[model samples]
Target: MADDYLVRIGKLIRDARQHRGWTQTQLAEALATSQSAVNRIERGNQNISLEMIARIGEALDSEIVSLGYSGPMHLRVVGGRRLSGSIDVKTSKNACVALLCASLLNKGRTVLRRVARIEEVYRLLEVLNSIGVRTRWINDGMDLEIAPPAHLDMEAIDADAARRTRSIIMFLGPLLHRLRQFKLPYAGGCDLGTRTIEPHMIALRRFGLDITATEGLYHAQVDRSIAPDRPIVLTERGDTVTENALLAAARHDGVTVIRNASSNYMVQDLCFFLEALGVRVDGIGTTTLTVHGVPAIDVDVDYSPSEDPVEAMSLLAAAVVTESELTIRRVPIEFL
Candidate 1:
């Protein structure tokens, strides 16, 4: 069994090196090892340490071996088994992740109630923890408490964790207020074709954020001297883009108006969260938002995000498909 595992790891390393168009000698030079060693490692003749595997992964910019990752999950469904019970929908996954990134805006503790413990959230937590943010699970692991440090160590961010979730782009809105310049790994998630970040850049540029993507890293520079002199118009009314604009505007210390924003459920949840942080938002369920930005936020806030409409709909669909009577609770009807 151990030999089989080693062979698989070796194959993965060989494939990744080939994908990068690097020869064995080139890879050996990159790792400061001999070509023969690389050949042995790729042929499973060498017993490579975990540290060496990690170094190879970093050098190739590939996930050779995910440490805690699980294999594909399978669900065997049996017919005639009715799922009939009271189902309580958890908070919106999109909103939870957006709020998690927004927590960086607050210096004091931020407690989120009943957060969805999805893999995306876990990845973001890993990135946050790596950047000097203190996070802990409380209340039987259903609640999350995030507290930012006095100084964020941006250089110590977990690039692997950041690359696994596309939501990491939301960090730009909050991090800009804290760090003048920093580098973030490019966002990665499900393969959904080429999703451009141009809309995000167009909106963020109003707040003096200039991003240059080079070599799988976004080099971000913020000019604090620049502020929105006029109403900022969004190029695309995307939910995350609107949230990013809101995040950038949250600390502008002026009345900033955003046009063509998304009035989706997640955006509303984020607006409510911003309000809790003492940033006044004029429009809650409208496309246009006038934000009264505060120069700083350092209050401990506890917020319970509303239930996800999509989850509630999924439960309803399951009940209908199985011909079972299920009581779905906490549906955000406003969104539907």
Candidate 2:
């Protein structure tokens, strides 16, 4: 049993080395050991000590064996501690997910500045990666650099990742422009309780998309000849639904008007991104939007989405709740 464990660990080390395109001799030099010693370790013949195991993990940049940790995070609070100064507001999860899905519209690279690193974003990234979208966090995870492949592999979509976030439904808008037909697993998140997907369906159907939800999957079929012949009035002004409409409209060639649209923070961010892709949007921060959609967009764009208004308001609420006099910077007051 011990010999079997050694063999598995050796294979892991060897696989990591090859994945990095590192030669056995190069790994030996990094560890200050001969190639023969590295060979013995790879073959599970070397008696590796704990210190050497730690060294090997450090060189390979992975945890071969972890003690692991599990606990709920706690905040240490001292009573009556006065709070002062200001903190910059972070990005929005809504905006980040919208931006990530909208990246499919551009043929060139898309670099988003100061995106929030949240669970929603990570879930969307997993879905993107599974479908061949290459995304990386640069600038200490403050920014995201996304580069799409020549084509997305829809068959390999990550169903588990897709089901983790309701934001996955927003992908329908951009994807309708890419493929004729595809299936996405049902969206599940936050226990929001039978939130009507009808509004999204009604809005997207105007852009030639027909979606049917059955047996734990949504089958989407696109009619390429069909485009929004008239204004698309959303049934609800929900942020995610509005984003879905905006995404579908981004790749449409003619004028598309959306009424009863959301004037929330995330919708504004999506409009700004569409503009960067050369799509002209007439109304932002309003209930009505007139979008002049270009037939095709292939621009290498860089956009910095605005800060989170909800988080900013939370900071203000914190001051009132705790009776603390605090200053908050970079608040998007218009949204508030």
Candidate 3:
């Protein structure tokens, strides 16, 4: 038990260091410790003290351990004691997934800078790598590089891996281009009410993707020859659905007009990224979008997704809870 604890902490430390783009020598300098000590800690070769852990976390700019957040469940407590410290929000769950889906378009390696190390992204990566995508944890698990494979190993897909995340739905955009026929376990994420896959279906229909839900799995069949004939109209102001439509449109060979599209932050990010990949998207930051897909995309694009607003709000809430006056930079107040 003690060894596992150190290993977890060591992993956290190593992850934080890699996330920060720091070398062991740099981390050692920050912590005022020897590089050998940092190496041993990352290797889980030595026992560390709580004071040392806190110092290491401070140097790494990560909490590493926090109250109210545990594995498996998001625990919320109504009645709580007062505090005097402050905290910053992490990142948005929505934007992270959108970016993950967007990574599938590039032929060159896609490196997501400072990705949220949440359970949600973890599940998507698991599913992505399982299907022959070369996903590497380059920097202490913070930097993610996703590379496309010549042929996907669809049978190796982790049903249990993807079923835990709603982000699995985003695979529709990437997988449609990779496989004509495939099956994925039903998506499960937050209980934020009924999030229908109907929007995804409506969006991808223009690209000839027909997905059917049967026995806790999504059976999808794609006929790539069928392209959009007319403008695709969305049913809701849904963000993910709009993104799915945008992604599908980005890869199609002709121009696709999408109506009632979400002008949400995530969709905007995805649009900007698509443009980076040489897909011309008009009416961005608006309800209507026109996408001109590339017949073949081979550009090595590098993009940094914007900061999340919800995370900024959570950080503010932390300041409120602790009754501390704190300054949270890049709060993304525009979204609020």
Candidate 4:
């Protein structure tokens, strides 16, 4: 446990140094130590004293260590303690998934700011890693950095990790742009009844993908010649479905129109991300989106997804149920 903390703190120091555009030698000078000593500290090869940790935090202007307060998970006194202060909503899991899949579209490095440290994100990272994409959590684990492999090792995919979330469906759109043939396990996650994936198939087929589901797997084949010459109308306005279409359209090299689309928070965040990738998207907040696809995307982009509306709603529901006064910040009122 002590070693783990030391490694995490070391990562925090390295991230802070990079953020400030400082070299190891520069940081070593600031710390009045040799570059080799600083390197050892950053690599977690040397144990650091608390005084040195505090000095490093001060030098980097970061709170590398945190003391979290634990609270009861269950109600024992009928919510006797009234909540009064405001709390900010964290980043969205949906956006994080969308952005992770979208990162495959870029050949350069992708940096995401303040991404949420959720199980879903961790699973997605596992899948990405299994397929040869290099990823790391840095900047006190608030940021994520990803670099795509020259060629993906599809056979090495982490099937267990990929099956943990239904967000795996979003991979269809982006992967279509990268591979001509690939197989994915049946989409899994929270069992919210028998929700059909027919809509996803319908949207992706417009971009020349043919998917066949049989015996717990989806065998996907792509026809490189297929492109949407006209507007593609989605059968459903589901957020992941819309994001799938957007991911496909992003690298299509022509204008693709999507109707009956989702204007949800995650989809909007995806649109902004597509724009950052140099794809033009119109109607970001509405049900119709016109995406002018580019032939290629190779930019080292940095993007920050919006706050979670569902989280805000959860806080509001807790406050109302407990009859306690609380404030939720960054609610993304448009979602309401």
**For each candidate, what TM-score against the reference?**
0.76, 0.72, 0.68, 0.71
On TM-score, the leading prediction is 1
Every model: Cα RMSD to truth:
7.4, 11.8, 14.9, 15.4
Model 1: runs farther than 4 Å from truth? Answer: 1-83, 189-195, 320-323
What overall lDDT, based on C-alpha atoms, would model 3 receive against the true structure?
0.78
Residue-level lDDT tens digits of model 3 in 97-201: 888878777776777766777888888888888887888777787667788877778788887677667777888886787679998766652221245777677
Among these predictions, the greatest lDDT belongs to 1
lDDT of candidates 1 onward, in order? 0.88, 0.84, 0.78, 0.85
Q: What TM-score would candidate 2 get against the native?
A: 0.72
Q: What's the CA error at residue 83 for candidate 1, in Å?
A: 4.8
Clashing pairs for model 4 are none
Q: Least accurate stretch of 10 residues (summed lDDT) in model 1?
A: 188-197
lDDT per residue for candidate 4 within 74-102, as digits (tens), equals 75565556678889899888898899999
Residue pair clashes in candidate 1: none
